[model samples]
Target: MGDEWRAGGFGLYIHWPFCEAKCPYCDFNSHVRDAIDEPRWRAAL
Candidate 1:
């Protein structure tokens, strides 16, 4: 596939699961919070 495709033409996909704020019009999974514990979250990750 790599040899068949053009050198500069490629696609990358990333899935993000966390959002601090939620939008009314969005159908994605999101949450709103007042504060975040970075160290704890990083450890969990």
Candidate 2:
């Protein structure tokens, strides 16, 4: 684990895709959800 940390280690990329409003030129893997199920979201992780 120490050696791995010295080199390129693992990562956790969490894409929180909730926004108040989307942009005009949005070209990313995201979403604009009105309401998010907090319990459901936690269960996924």
Candidate 3:
């Protein structure tokens, strides 16, 4: 169990294609795209 954190390390990741409002509690990376293609986005990921 201890090896997992040691080997992989600790971190956080968030993926947001569109963020209309700002969140008070959260201080993470985010982006707001005016237009997004759902199919293309999924395929690229």
User: How much lDDT does each candidate structure score?
Assistant: 0.64, 0.76, 0.66
Q: Report per-prediction Cα RMSD to one decimal.
A: 4.1, 3.5, 4.8
Query: Candidate 3: what lDDT?
Result: 0.66
Ten-residue region with minimum lDDT total, candidate 2: 1-10
> What clash count goes with each model?
0, 0, 0
TM-score of 3: 0.37
Per-candidate TM equals 0.38, 0.48, 0.37
Report the candidate with higher TM-score, 1 versus 2. Answer: 2
Per-residue C-alpha lDDT of model 3 across residues 1-45, encoded as one tens digit per residue:
466677778666547555665677767675656676768867877
Clashes of 3: 0
- Candidate 1 vs candidate 3: which has greater lDDT? 3
Q: Candidate 2 or 3, higher TM-score? A: 2
Model 1: CA > 4 A from native: 1-20
